[model samples]
Target: MTKNERLFISPLPRYAYWLFLLGILISILLGLLFYRQVSAMVQHQAEAELKRLSASTSDQFQVYLQQTEYGMNQAATEQYIQTAIEKRDAEVLNQLLYGWQQNRNHAELWAILDKDARIISTLRGSSDNHNPLSLNGLALRAMASANPIVSTEIINKEELARVGRNVSDRLENHHLLKQEGVLTQLVIVPVLGKNGQVLGALCGGLVLNDNQELLRSLFGNSQAMHAVYQDKQCIAYFTNDNKVSFPEQISPAMTKSCILDGQACLGQMQSDGDTYVTVSRYIFNAQNQVIGYQVLALPQSQYSQLPAWVANISLLTGFLLAIFSIIVIGNTSRIRQLFDRERQRGQESYYLGMFAQKLQECTDENEVYLLLKKYLSRDLDVIQMEFNIISADDNCMESIRFTENDQVSRVYLNQSKCKPVLTGRINIYNDDRDLHCNQIDTDLIKSHVCIPFLAGGKVAGVVGLGSPQEQYWTPGRIEYLDAYLNLIGPTVTNIRLLKLLQAKAFEDQLTGLKNRHFLDQYLLEQLAIAERYKTTLSLLMADIDRFKLVNDNFGHDAGDLVLKEVAAVIRAAVRESDLVARYGGEEFVLVLPNTSTDEAVSLAERCRQAVNSLQVIHNDYSRIISVTISIGVASYPRDGNSLEALYKLADSALYLAKNQGRNQVRTAQEYLATLQRTGCDD
Candidate 1:
């Protein structure tokens, strides 16, 4: 051997080069095998956890479901719900719900949904355990699932319908009670009738960070087991009795896995530097329908130190290090470049992974927009970043621009060179324009890229990202964005669909006013607000004083027009806080919140006058028809404290108005007293 070679060689280990190469190959192969094994083990553990916890939670959910059915059965006979159903004691139901709120911690909220999913009553408080339940969130979810008709049929189905279906059980976390606070996780269980109908769901939750006992019971006493719910969906990680939390961001991988596989998912995927064993199960109702999913995960840190193949591979490779060293020395410059490229790739990959994770966690569409801006500014090392989402239905885009001095102004999305981005059709954007990057000295416009948020197979919105000059959009970045959209799009779509469904539920198609069902709900809400604020809530009952008039005289078409016109008058007469609805044919009800009986009477009188003075052109003829309305007024804690009582008093007063003289106002108490004192002896 040459002297120089001999000097470089280690005297004790001559077979080191061959052994090192062999070890490298073995290490990679063995490590992969170990990883797979660990993954399997983790999956097994996660499934076991899900089976155990899901069983427990499912049981709890069932109990609530039972309670709801029982309530429905009772309400069928009970005066409160029955009256509300028959529109006889509508105010009574509201009073009960208000009283029920006082003892909220006792149980979950139980509601009776009409064909529309509007809450009729909630025995328990909301997920936040404070605010009265509103259809804003739940209706969206209900609408997304089967249509409203399903409930009518379901209500009549047998208990057997609960069998063999994946019953949904999940937690809802939101800043409902404390504004600007961490999301609170609440458990929601649906109440399905024996006839395969959903009466309403029982919604209640364990206070986040409060019920450690229950948490440990479900997830085990593990620091890694943490549960969080977003928009009625949940994700949790468990380790022993302690729990760790998942960020409220969703990842592209998770999103894809969820949609492709279904909501309840369990898998071991690449994230950060370690592998985690995860188990996800979808929450379902008593009918075994999908609600949301629960995720149980274990970090690799827990089992990484175990005697696995990766450690063995490393141990075996050490003996062959010298052989690899010799080979590596022959190509030093190439190795350096390779290492640099890998490092760059690694950094980019890390950011992308984080971005994916956050994307999956987000529930609201707007959150996606905010995340894009943040990632471009922080992860991409951009000087200035701005983005806008073009509303497919409306012009919804934000803009920002940059000058030569790196001075950035938030330009609108409309001002950006959007043609290329629109052409790319990618859901994520970064600086992909070569010309823009080369020409711009400022960071804001240099690395501009845009991604569209698609819903229902169409571009519903766009997300744009940017960095400083000469930025190139790589396939990796595009892939990263595509991954994010894969997760975000469905969630956005679901939310949108949910809103549409809810809107359909409470709306009257012909008159475009709140329906009878909606009126009941609104009355309940107003009653509670009035009680809380100790203010008056006045109800005005007005019936179109006429000949069945428009319908009988001008046909049903003219009657429909009169109804529409009357609705418009009521809508205009009431403040936003007031509730207006078509109580029945030719009769309308207006609930004026925080209004006194005098105010309600005055409001009703105005409505009557408006109707009487209005001219209706039937059959394209300017036919001036004088229509009049009989008005009745009732106030809370005076006329009655209950919805039913108030309504009854109003109706009685309305009867008196009709009896004495049409288009006049009257009170139930006064008329009733007069009736008792002066009996017309025939």
Candidate 2:
């Protein structure tokens, strides 16, 4: 044979070709396995992230509902609300409801319903011109359960009008109105009398269809899509750009699998020829019933592209290796570098996930800031960290700084440096000169970044991190910082909101004293303590004499002034250890621990004398009015053993004092003797 043919036909060369082909096949199989593993992992991570976002959105919705209910409850306890309901005054109800609705920006519509479930007045407009809003199912349920209710079932204008007409026509129909339409979520809370009787229901509506700002704030303004489904139909939808739109009546299979089943569903769906990985969760009402579904869609192209590229690169590398086996040995270091980069990325993700989990466990702003500082300083090698909390009440910035020496210092940031942050924008400083602040340590800090903590589309606070080295804040680090702030921002806002709600829950807004809720809780706790230690516990119940006359003569405004003055006097007369609460309309209760009935009588007398000496100048009438309060004193173990018994005895004594003229302090025994004398005279 010829020389060229002999070299080509050599068995050694043939074996090498077969080996090369086999190696190519093996590499293809390995690439397929790698692609599947990576794709599954990426999908899982994406789903988890989406679920977290959905959960956060759900929590924000709940908080909004809570705030609305709290505002309604506060309004329900207002003196004006009670007065308007008692006198059936629509004008007064409208004024009170409108003012309350304006004060609470979240309230869309405010209405006051009578005990018979008839709408007495609404802030929407005049009751004569606008038909009364019917008591919807949510309101009825809330009234029945004596708890707040949140419902997402939409009720349109026409249907509401029909229900209102039916309610008016029946006159005696006390059943809940059965109406559903396209309206939004409603939060209904019942207004209760002093004896815990449901006097009326207060309803606040949140129209979600046009509430783009709220949806964007809750779902995040990013490349993430969100939709709200009611009755398996898309009622509201938001795109990745935060634009509000409604999806047409097309039934999505995922809705049945996820919403109807009440389970979180994750899968891929094709829409408009583009693939998307969708995650759906059931949105529940305050009654713990599934009201609707919330769907989050992410483009599959975004995640799948990386894995596809990785697989192609593996295949190309395998082909090159088969062609040049010697080159593989030389490129080992390059392969190791790629592996190391991936490992670093994975570690960063793990750390971020861990930090987010820890952050969610924090319940206070200070704790959140401290946790952020610890993690940022340790993970990112930050030299100095500072957090500025924006006070919504005062419009001031309270700052906490952490130094390299592990020292924490609290300070205040000036208005100029905090303006940009308070404007809800991220400020990046490549050098210390960019930060025009006296608080910045220019000598120690070379670079820094400031990110705002946003909540409800507003800046709640700002977080800053500094490094001694130049160019230390990279793009990746900034992205991680953004993630951290996003998680902690809502948390801080929630904590502050909860704190405010807690204060409101126990306080009387009108009189600025503790309310009946606080009175009951504190009285029970003190009574338990008194019983355990065999200590004396005295109770005093005081009522304004002829309070209705003050309201009827001088108007409700004057009555409010009198109540405020009485509360102030009562608070002044008692010691700091004593507990004073506005029990109800024209009534105040005091719990005196370790005190006898004599001490209680003296305190009550002092309070009455202070009120009698005061000249309450009404701002509205520009007239002075004299006020007198009747008091009744009862001591634990002497008058009664239980709180209910003691309260009843004190109340009876107060009634007796009111009956025998007015303006005097009487003990439980004194009133009983007066009753006996009256019986003998009869």
Candidate 3:
């Protein structure tokens, strides 16, 4: 046989198969052994690197959390917050936060909340771009925690909302974790009062996205170590790396991770069987309170730079060489195609993740909704995209649609000649001449894709995506939108609930003097401090002497008028800090935290005189009526230590003043005889 034929043909028939199998077996064995060794080495090195990096990152995060806690605590305790709280001036708080947010290089946003957690002021990077960071779940959590609660996880926009807190709990909802190339960290600190109540929360963040310098600092910077601050405000350090110290800017994730994990994860590394490893720890305050967190990550490629598959192939070659011959298969082009699609999918996933992240960072639901519409319009190149907020009544959808020029239009189905895309239920279609279409009076959305916005398992609103011209819609685009709706729908519902709750809390259902509930809690706190400091604290109890007579004479309508009249008179009598709470029935309680008893009594008398001299015409019969109030004064420490006690003392005085003369001021001591005769606490 010629050389070519001989090479192509088998050299030895039976023996050749045996030898080949033996060789393959030998290669497989070698490969297995090599893979094990490589894996072990990579794991050890990766773990070491991750440990070092985690230590550095964690330390830095702790430092940043500490600084933020300090700053927020300092700010919350400042006269500014106090002044704003006293004055109920949200603008003052906003100005303060806006000033802080303007400071470049600081990853901090400041906000002040009244007791009700309303966004009084928010300071972000720019004034025009600033969004109100609504406090809903966060405020509830903050109020529940006694220490500076750290959130288990933080949404980006939420971080922008809550700028300062010492301890945190993860919000029940969390943003999807990004495990692609970009890394994120979120940290939250609660601004606490002296009584260990959460006045507000502070949030900070750090991103490890294309920031190579920060990554280099973790691996390359020698002075990097992990440190944490406890509730007692003491700093503690923990690290395996001897050479590394902390950085000024800490990632939020590290802080969040440490607080969540509970125990100190000194050198823990989790591998994804690929190139990266994550290490994390739980931080505790001096009071054994877990206030901070730290985490670090490292790339396996950092050590030796060997492909993981190399080790598997090497091990297989040594231990299971026979497997190599069997491994060679006939599928090539099909596998390559699958791999290409996967690669494209990865890229799409990355962009989608980034879009979602940015979406989560949006403080305005409308902005996010518009952004989604824009993405569907511009990114997907859809002809048009529309969103609607479903109204309570089934009349029409509140159209929240966006255009190419970023113009938003609301198409009311009832008012305009638009086709009813929805009557009472959710509807989606690609119709051109729908009545809702005419609702879009602008020429932009003549026709396009339309979807209904559902919330709380009901059709809350309708979303109409329109195109001036006819366009093709794809299943993938629809799928993307479905996902977007899934995220935004719940957020919108939550915001709506939040707004409703906020209105109920801040608004008065009746007389509107803040509220008795808010006043009793807030003023009692102020009074407590005044009492502690030996400062003057006063309370005035007033009762409209003849209020009941109005109810008897003019039916309940006239009685309601008198109550409103009394409320107006009371409001006109005192300054803002001096709260007037409707104690009960026709009586009102005035709390003056920094006023002397004499001043309080004088103020009460003014309200009394105002009510007495005021005339109300019952009818056209030309009959005029006037009412007077008996005033009671009680001073803190001199009267009683507690709110209830002061109220009782003042009420007793009021009763005595009423009995002695209908419209005169009386002190608690002056009413002591009456209290003894009545044998009642009042």
TM-score per candidate: 0.49, 0.55, 0.37
Name the weakest run of 10 consecutive residues (lDDT summed) in model 1: 149-158
Backbone atom clashes (below 3 Å) for every candidate: 74, 1, 74
Give the residue spans of candidate 3 off by over 4 A.
Answer: 1-331, 392-396, 402-407, 415-436, 440-447, 467-471, 511-545, 548-682
lDDT of candidates 1 onward, in order: 0.53, 0.69, 0.54
Give residue 507's lDDT in candidate 2 (0 to 100): 91
Per TM-score, the best of the predicted structures is 2
Off by over 4 Å in 2: 1-362, 370-378, 383-386, 395-449, 466-470, 619-622, 659-661, 669-682
Model 1 misplaced regions, further than 4 Å = 1-363, 368-378, 383-387, 395-445, 622-625, 679-682
Ten contiguous residues minimizing lDDT sum, candidate 3: 165-174
**RMSD after Cα superposition, model 3:** 19.0
Ranking by lDDT: 2, 3, 1
Query: What is the alpha-carbon lDDT for the whole of candidate 3?
Result: 0.54
Error of 3 at 463 (Å): 1.9
lDDT, candidate 2, 1-682, per-residue tens = 8898888884667889889878887877776665566456655555555565555556556655665565566567765466567667887676556555544454455667766566777654545324445534666667778887777655665534432323223322322223245436777778887788887777767655444555666555346677776556565667764333334442464544442234666655566667777677765555566666677777765544232344556676566333332333333444446446545655655565666656556766777887887777667766667888778574678888766655678887665557557476766777766766665688888887778777645777778777887777788778778877876755565566556656765799899999987788899999999999999999999999989999999899889988998899889989999998999999999899999988888888889899889888887557889989999999998889987898988998998898888999889998778879878531
Better of 2 and 3 by lDDT: 2
Q: Across residues 1-682, which tens digit of lDDT does each residue of candidate 1 receive?
A: 8999889876657689778677777765655555556556544544544444433444433333343333223333332343353342324444544433332333323344333444444332221222334332443355345222111111111111111011112222322212222222233334444454544443333233223344554334223444434323333333452223454443434434442245455555344455665545554434455434455555645433233443444456553334333433433444346446545644554554556556545545556656655665564545544444455355545554434453445544552456534664653334344534322344355555556656656665555555554535677666655554544554455445434545655788888987888899889988998899999888888888874856777788788887788788768766787778888888888888888777877777777777777776767676755577888888897879899998888898898899888878887666677678888421
Q: Which ten residues in a row have the lowest lDDT in candidate 2?
A: 170-179
